[model samples]
Target: MADTEFVIEPGRQDLVMIRMFDAPPDVVFRAITDPELIPRWWGPHVLTTRVDRMEVRPGGRWRYVNVDAHGREWAFSGVYHAVVPPERYVRTWEFEGAPEEVALETVTLTEVDGRTRYVAQSVHPSVEARDAIVRADGPRGGRESMDRLAVLLGTVADM
Candidate 1:
């Protein structure tokens, strides 16, 4: 498989990230939604993730925290709007620090020739909010996170 190229495109009030994985849709989907697997690859390498709560079902609530090496924690929470295993999921995402700036995120996984194309679209309440996420180096973090996911998937495959 080729190297995964992560692309982040910002629209009027939304941001889209595209990444290709060497694994199938089911594998990639589990990597994202599985609570135990999430702590292994959800954040940057410099941080440790803690899943406070994760319920992957319609109307379910989830929360997670990532603590950097320095012990500074960043927390995020969301509510699942829809869940279609190995295919798509929609949720409302909110950073605990800025809860008012919530975004509706939809993640889709499509398998093509045994590979999965993962697309995440985050629709913010306003253009400025979406731009703020971009300015916060969200793209870099996202790219790194996905790269980590690939490595985790390799290990999961072995298991």
Candidate 2:
């Protein structure tokens, strides 16, 4: 598995994450957009994820909740702005705990030598907002999620 790289530039309100998967774009895309498969690899290993709502089309809404061992839940919700299967999608992301700090996120998957290169760009409302996420170890969570996704892709690559 390739490392999940995060690009955070100074004075910028956006962050970009890149990772490579040993699977085709279609397979990778399916693994990401399929609600049934999401809970399998959507968050940290210690948390159980549940897809409360997922409508994978333009103007559709999606929500996911992660529950810890102690039964504490963290929810995230978003609305899809654009959707192109196996290629890209743009959406808004907001943690229910801090709804005011919504961010616009664009995810793109590119084919590279038969593998998939996944890139996600998240634009926050301000530099402070972006910095806050960094301070909160958002990248670490993202890395863990991607690591899980990679493992899932390996299992479902032939499906």
Q: Provide the overall lDDT of each model, using Cα atoms, as 2-decimal numbers.
A: 0.87, 0.94
- For every candidate in turn, the CA RMSD to the true structure comes to 1.8, 0.9
* Candidate 1: tens digits of C-alpha lDDT, residues 1-159: 344444445558888888888889998998899899888888777789999999999999999999987899999999999999989999999889999999999999999898898899999999899889888888777778888998888887742
Lowest lDDT sum, 10 consecutive residues, model 2, at: 150-159
lDDT tens digits by residue: candidate 2, 46-147 = 899999999999999999999999999999999999999989999999989999999999999999999999999999999999999999989988999999
| Top of the candidates by TM-score | 2
lDDT over C-alpha atoms for residue 47 of model 2: 93
Off by over 4 Å in 1: 1-11
Residue 33 of candidate 1: its Cα lDDT? 93
Candidate 2 deviant stretches above 4 angstroms: none
RMSD of 2: 0.9
lDDT of 2 at 61: 100
Give each model a TM-score: 0.93, 0.98
Clashes of each: 0, 0
